[model samples]
Target: MNITKYVLVLLVMPFLFGCNSDDYQYPDKYLPNYNFSIDIDMSLPLYTPLQFTANPVYIDQAGIGINGIIVMNTGGGYVAYEASCPNQNLDSCSKLAVDGIMAICPCDEAEYNLFNGQAEGKEYPLKPYRIQVTSGTSIRVYN
Candidate 1:
């Protein structure tokens, strides 16, 4: 009975302590969630820039993301983030513009790294979407 109790406590202890309260989660107060799926072909002329590392593109297609979606090639792989500023309310100025390896929000000049979607000196990170490399020449971004 003592050995069986020890085994049960070992199994139950991990489940009770596994959850970390400090885990960072992007807040949804500012940018509302939208369901969208978009695919890009690297062979296409418009998306040819994505073939290179650190090159970011802003797709302004309507109803895709809150404002749009920013896709970038991080050399080793691809990452996609929402194009709106995570720290600000959704406004015309909340749209982020691609500048070099970072995306700059015109509202307050909050720059976010496109590679990892982290904001410069800010607690909130740019909301990221799920990306899948469909093939050698194609990628899909969805949320």
Candidate 2:
């Protein structure tokens, strides 16, 4: 019975200690959660720029996202990110502006790559949204 108990403990010890508790914490910890779903029609005049590669559009409609959503056409596919800077709370300068394929935070000048939402030497990456290509001319972004 003692030998069996030892074997059981050995098996469970790895299960308990092998997992990293910090894994539960997300990289984008500063941004608050918001529930929203928005669809963009690529054929529309406002969204027509997204049909080309590296053309990013900022949809600043109220309640669309934390600040808003920055939708980009990477040529490979459509990518959407929360326009709020990930490294800090939402502020006047937290809104990201499209600078080519990079989103620049006006406050800190932190640049995040639109292709992957990563900022160089920054701990947090831009918050991403789920993108569904409903058709050749439409996409749904949700979070």
For TM-score, the strongest prediction is 1
Model 1 regions lying over 4 Å from their true place: 1-25
For each candidate, give its TM-score against the true structure: 0.83, 0.81
lDDT of 1 by residue, 16-119 (tens): 88877645355798988889999899899989989999888889898789889999999899999998999898998999988999899899999898988888
Report every candidate's CA lDDT.
0.89, 0.88
Clashes of each: 0, 0
* lDDT string, candidate 2, 69-100, tens digits: 99988889989999988998777888898888
Assess candidate 2 and give its TM-score to the true structure: 0.81
RMSD after CA superposition, every candidate: 3.9, 4.2
lDDT for model 2, on a 0 to 1 scale?
A: 0.88
